[model samples]
Structure formats: C-alpha cells, structure tokens
Target: MTLSVHWRLDPAAEPRRSEPGAWQRLPALARDRRVSTQNRFDYFLQVAQAAAQTAFDGLFVRHRIEADESRIIAAIIARAVPHIHVVPEFPASVGSAVYAAKQATTFQRAAHDRLGWAIAPDAEPAGREAQADFVSDGDLAQRLDEFLTVARGVHRERPFSFKGSYFEVENGGFDAPLNRASFPRVYLQGSGDAALALSGRHADMHLFAPASTEALAKDIARLNALADGRSVAAGLIQPLLVRDERQTAERDARDRPLAPGTLVASYDEAAEILAGFAAIGITELVLEATPTLEEAYRIGQHLLPRLRALTSAARQAA
Candidate 1:
C-alpha cells in the first residue's frame, strides 16, 4: 500500500437536490475539514483496517487531540501500519479567524491527552507529557519561540528553549521519545497568508479543494516559495464528480447538476482533470462522493475499478 487516501470528515448537512417535502437540496458545507467528522468514529477502526488490507497505505486522523488520545490513535493505527497523522484543526470558517489563535493559546492546557502543559501521567512508550506545542498570535518571534520550545520536548536530542512574545521555555525534554525517531508528517488545509506560512514552516503536507490544473500549479508554486526549499510535500483531494467511462465523467460534469463544478463528466475528463493536479505537484487526490452514501459507494465499487484499469494501461503504455 503505497498510495494514501484520507477522508476529510467535515460533518455538515449540505442542501439536498430537491424540495422540503421530497428531498431537500444540499449546499456546500465542510464542518471541520478535519478527519474527526461524525460517522467516522464508528467506522474509523474498521476503515483503517480496510485501507490497510486493501491498496491504501496509511491513515490520518484529524482534530486537535490530547497527547494521550494522539498516542492511542497512533498505537491503534500502528498495529496495522505505522503512518498516522494527527491534525489539530482546520479553520473552515472565515468568521472565526481567531479560533486558531485561541486554540493555540490553550493548547498546552487542553487535557492529559491534549497538546498542553500536562499529559497523561502514564502513557505507553512512557514520558508522553513533553510533546505539547504552544500556539499564539501577534508576534513571529513569539510563535517561533513556542515552536522551538515544543519541538525540543518532542525532539529532545538537541534540547530547545526560547523567550519571545508568544512563548518562553528552557531545557525542555520529552518524557518518552517518539516511537519513530522523527515525527510523522503533519497536514494542514487552508488558503490564508498566515495559514500558508505556518504550513510552509512546519507542516509536512498540505491539502486543497478542487481547482483548474493551471490554477493549482500556481498555488503549489506559491506554497513552495514559502517553503524556502524545505522538504515538505503537497496533496490535492478533488471531488470526484464523474465516472471512469468518458461518457460518465462528461455526462456527470455537465448534467448531474448536484454541486456546480462538482462532477468532471467522464473518466478521460477525470484523468485530464487529475493530470492538471499532478502537474501542479499534487501527490495524492481523494475523489470525493457525490451527494449521498449511495453515490459514494457507486464510485468506490464501479468508477474506481475502471479508473484503476485505465490508469494501469496508461502507465504501461508510457
């Protein structure tokens, strides 16, 4: 399982495609843009195993979590495979601009398992209390101080400490080292100047919504510029509003009329759509479901197979 497919679990009711009496129309809504959306709690363990059993390689659980919770989730995922990413949160709402800032300030005090001053007194692999990273706003020096402080506890090899507007720390060390020498890649999703800068400096991966290939290429290049040659990777998870069959992708993109610009109309169209993303340096794409679970199932069961076949043929020919 080399390719990874992560489900962005934002639990919001979009307007359905009908009337109030029949089936209401569903509008565009992404509650969290994090993987902790509802229904997933029930199916996550199963889904994780399923993905591991199948061709997909890893799992990334979203939501800002306590260290204990993070460790528990990581351990659960490690049983099947060792790669799991814990996303703190996604600023899905434009109105809540300070949401991340507030969360960052309290990050170290959330809970035993949360990113905070305290962690579970006793966690497996031992000494888990030292991984909390402080979050704040207003000053870059402060934020970097906070980051360095937390990175030291989590890293501990060359203990880190700093004093600045947002944070201050000294001689921090981890209670227990990471199971893996280095941390797994962290992921972020947003399109803001601050968010982009933070991801470029710290995040291992970044996600984006669907966009034209040319547009997406520019976006990736912008992010790369922020990275300053750091080894961060990028991914795109476009909505799969089409089918592998050329007719399906075309028909769906043109006629389905579920979400405007949601479908691609045909497989060839879908391929062309994806080629644009790949060209933009997107490493992975999570083709989303249409409007309902049934539609999602149809894609997983039907469209995926055909697309996979077509992709295989093209690869061989190339």
Candidate 2:
C-alpha cells in the first residue's frame, strides 16, 4: 500500500492559541479582516503552494459553519496549485445530487481529475435542520447513500434514473464533456457501524478520528469486514507537534496543550509512530498543525521524509 499525506486547510485564520503568548495578546481587528476577499484567496493559494512544495499528495479544505465556504476555496486553490488533489468537505444535503455532480464534473475537468469530496456528517439538530429537514440518523444515512448514488450515476452514464426516499431522478444524466470527466474520490468520516456500512458501499477512503493504535487497528478490521472485499482505504485525521529532540517536544506539549491524541514527539519517534500506523493499514493521513504556514514546511522538512523512509524500509522488509 502507498501512504499519502494531506494537509488540512482552514479557510479562515485559525486561532493561534498554540503559539507562545498567543492567548495573552489582544485581538487585532484590522489583521482579522485580511482574510476577507482577495487576501483570503491569497492565503489559501499560499497554503496550497506550500503543501505542494512539501510533496503532500493533497489539500483537505475543512468545512464548518463559521468558516468560509469550502468548495469555493478548494476550487480557487485547485486552479492555482494543479499538482495536488484539492478536497472540499460539505454536507450532502446542501444541493441536488445531480446539480452537485454537474459542479463536480466541471471541477474535475478544470483540475485534471484532482478533485476529492469529503462528505461532512450531519451537524447538531438546529444546524442539521438549517441544511435540510430534520431526520433520524437512519434516514440521514439513507439520504446520503441516495445522494452519492445519483451523483455517481449521472457522472458515469447518460439517462441515469433513480428513485429514493430523499431524491428522485427521471432520465437524468450528463452529456459530452461533463460525462467524460472522472468522478471525484469520495471520503467519509466516522467509526460507527452505520458510517462503516455507508462507506463500504461508496467511499474510496474512510477517515477516522485519532485513536489509540490498538483501537485504530480494531476499527480498520471492522471496516474491512464491513467492506466485504471492496477496496476501501483506511486513514486517520491527526495533528502533529514534532521537534528535533524529545525534551523540546515535551516542552512544546506542555506549553501548547494540544488536543488529546496529537502526536508530540521527536522526529524519529514521530516517524516510528506514523510508520506503525501504516503497518496496521493506514495508507492515508490528514495532518494539521497550528499556524499552518510555518508548520507545513516544518513537518515537510523534518517529519515527512523520515516517515517515508521508515515506511519504505518496512515495505522492503515485507
């Protein structure tokens, strides 16, 4: 299996709480507005360029109610940086499946088939209702299933027809240039049985929140069983705070207090941990760090090469 690394991009500036004295500083309203129009596009483009320079395989544009729209950011970055995949996460209920597919088709054509779709899970009750009518989890799963079904159907062939509880299409499909583009890779996140089953049916890659190695191994095994021979790549969304020495790493962790499950270690230890994850079937990793601009280069310069070398040796030994 090949291991691919992707950097997570936040459309708006992320809180710099992890940096020294960041929390103590007063907010700068003038600086905050820099991410508004053209500057926002420049920020995303710069990040994309940095990720590509670091040899990352893709950029994962995050989705959140407070953030700028993910797909638009992704499109802008994708156009500016053509070498890496640009994945945008969004709720499946945002638009008609056929229309979404049409937009995706256009994106694929423009970006040379480098577009990816990470379908965001349903938000909280009020947030969910804001996107679409409130529905049970079971119904939501069914709706997503149908949504992907129609989106993919229209992309692959003409006159595709589908009738589902949440969606219905009659002789609906794309034409000529639209039908010729390849479908975007589908990415789904969650560890529950329902999420696993849904991913097994459709997702090319399934992402899991950071977990203990043993727990992650078990989750991968369960997802594989659910896939029942389908090829569903396993991945993890993790944050990393690595340094040259163990003491420095520990000091940084003490100062930053990162999320639980973030890997805080020396470069060598971090490589070993990530390689261990690869050994257990994690072929993809979406990694993030605070102040993304500098951290992108830091990880790419120090950690990524070590991890790649370790995984390579493991592959050779096997």
Candidate 3:
C-alpha cells in the first residue's frame, strides 16, 4: 500500500545563523534581522523541495500568507513544488476574494498542471443574518459553479474577466492556455450540505476535519451520492507529535510537550481514524508533523511504518 505524505515546512527548523570557518568557538554571527525575504523563501523552498524529492507519491502544502504578501509567497511556492496547492485562508469571505485572485495568478498561469485550490463552501443569506454563514445544499452547488468559472477564467486570460457576486477578476486571465491540467484540482472542507454539494461537482478531494468514525462514514456516503461517476477522493489531517528515540533530552526538548494536547494520543487515535476512513472509502491521509524537526523525522521513520502495517492488515481482513 502506497501512502502519500504531505510534508509541511516548519519555521523553527530554519537555521539561525551561518556557521563560518568550521567549529570555531566563536562562529560568525550573522544578524538574524539581516536575512532577506528571498533568503528565507529559498531556505524554506529547499526544505519543502528536499522532502518532496523523497519517496512520497504526492505532496500537499499548507501555506499561510497575508493578503498583500500573497504574490511573493505564491512565487516561492511555484518554484518549490512541481504541482502546488494554495489553500486560501478559511472563513473565506468577500474580503479574501482579491487576495485569492492574485495568488491564483502565480500558479494558474505558470503551474496549472501542478496546481489546485481548496475552497470552502460559501455561506448563505439566511445564515448571514445570524452570523452563522451555514452554507445550504443549494448554496454550495451554485458557489461551486462560480468558483470554478472564476478559476478557469483567471488561468486562461491575463486580464481578469470573471464577474460574480462574491468576486470579480479584472484584467486577470492567463495569457497562455493552462498546460496539461485544464482546471486546477480543487479540495473542499466541511460536512454541511453546501460543502458536500460543492465536493460532488467541483472538488477532486475532500479534507475531513477532526471527526468521529461514524460521522466520517456518514459524510463519505453523502459525498459519494453527489459524486456519481466522477472520481472523488477524501483525506484526513490530524496534528501529531512523534518521537521514536524518546530519550530524556529529546523528550523534554520536543515542542508538543506530550503531557497535554492530542499529540501523544494521536498515534492510536489516528490509527483508529485512518481505519475508519479507509473502511468508508477515504483514500489519503496527511499527518501533521510535530513542531520539532527531530520529532518529525522520528514519525517519518517510525510511526509511518506502523500506520502502513495497520492499513495493510485492515485491507487484507476486509
């Protein structure tokens, strides 16, 4: 069984300073503030690309960016991964439209075949009054159409031409046709009708937030109902902290603190969760590596194998 690993970049993993002239008691102290944005970007790109270049079959990146900072971040991402996924900040609102549009340009025009977007279902007018933004089934279907239309238009024409109630792309379409991939592969999150409907119509993958086994199973049924003939996939991402060596020093130094949070219990809980999703037809899982790079390495080296075995055993029993 092949398991796709979605490795995320950790800020703390970055080098603090350059070690000059080898192991001297006083290494060259490069001012931390002197690190250029491009330098940081290149460093992160190296980490992300190095991880991707490994044996993982596919990769998904979780990127965070400020509204104005998006272009630079997107450019960095385009340089790092062959195919990139830009997950726009969620609780997605009209405010985010312009930011999303601009970020989409970097990938849509240059990396369409290796790019995709994960959009959340838009909320409804009724819920708007309550500040609920609870997207209904109909709302999801309509929004799916709007989202895809805008995305395609942006990728095809340099000047934005799409005009929708939620967003309008102006002077913003791709100058050249999208290579290979016609439309960006979309992923959506949520359990509501609107979310499910959107997934059926537009999303290639559905990301399930922390949920119980039964709840996830029911969601799979709901999603499959709408997805008819198209190939629809599902994945789960759970925060984890892994430590294989578990030495006293390493244990104390780990960022997750192991005593609290679900980090420690995540191993078994995640196993059960993966089993549940697999039973219900969910195909992929993106395990959130712990905060410390050491812990992440441990998880990749040790924990992943156990999970792999569990999946194989479950499959054989079925």
Q: What is the C-alpha RMSD of each candidate to the true structure, in Å?
A: 11.8, 4.2, 7.1
- TM-score, cand. 1: 0.56
TM-score each candidate: 0.56, 0.90, 0.63
Number of the candidate with higher lDDT, 1 or 2:
2
Clashes of 2: 0
Ranking by TM-score: 2, 3, 1
Write down the TM-score for model 3.
Answer: 0.63
What candidate 2 gets wrong by more than 4 Å, as runs, is 13-38
Ranking by lDDT: 2, 3, 1
- Candidate number achieving the greatest lDDT relative to the actual structure: 2
Question: What are the per-residue Cα lDDT tens digits for candidate 2 across 1-318?
Answer: 789999998665563423233434347653433322344556677788989999999999988877679999899888888789999999887779999999999999999999999998788778887766687766888889999999999888778999999889999899897888999999999879989988999999999999878999999999999997799999999998889998898898888758667888899999999899999999999999877888898898889999999999999999
> What are the per-residue Cα lDDT tens digits for candidate 3 across 78-101?
665665343322334334444554
Error of 1 at 14 (Å): 11
Position 68, candidate 1: lDDT: 23
Give the candidate number with the greatest TM-score: 2
